[model samples]
Target: EDQVTQSPEALRLQEGESSSLNCSYTVSGLRGLFWYRQDPGKGPEFLFTLYSAGEEKEKERLKATLTKKESFLHITAPKPEDSATYLCAVQERKTSYDKVIFGPGTSLSVIP
Candidate 1:
């Protein structure tokens, strides 16, 4: 079975503060790792797709990196508008569809 765990279930930061969220996972026949940001009552918005170890992607104040067994979402100089729940998911090499497993998520609150 594939599984994902995120640390610091919730985080509070002052404006301009920076932090990192961790996503640890274990999966067989790894295919890809995904990062997303979700707002209250909204679906997750895709942020990145990491296909292999050492892969990384960035957008605005967010950066996502992947390794063999984990991934990180680094937030730099975050603002109140950046506050949201960040999600991490993984897709394994499987024949069936909907093989992606999502982590509970890290809820971030940036106070202005």
Candidate 2:
């Protein structure tokens, strides 16, 4: 079975603080690693897609990197508006594109 687990169910950070969250995955064959940011009561917004090891992608305040066994999401100088649930999902070779699974997520709060 393919599985993804995220650590630190919740994180509280003062404004402008930086931190990194971990996403550990176990899959038969990893087809894609996806990162999403979801706000309360809203659907997730796609952030990055990492395919191979040593690959990294970045956005405004977030960076995502992938390795053989896990992925990391680094937040740099987060702001109040950056507070949200960060989700990591993986599509295995056995799973179809329409049947992607998601991790519970790491809820982050940036206190102003």
Worst 10 residues of 2 by lDDT: 92-101
- Write model 2 residue lDDT over 1-112, tens digit each, in one string: 6779999999999999999999999887887899999999999999999998999999988999999999999999999999999999987875445447789999999999
lDDT of 1 at 41: 100
Q: What TM-score do all the candidates reach, one by one?
A: 0.95, 0.94
Clashing pairs in 2: none
* Candidate topping TM-score: 1
Please, what are the lDDT tens digits per residue for candidate 1 over residues 20-81?
Answer: 99999998877899999999999999989999999889999999999999999999999999
Model 1 misplaced regions, further than 4 Å: 95-98
Prediction 1 TM-score vs. true: 0.95
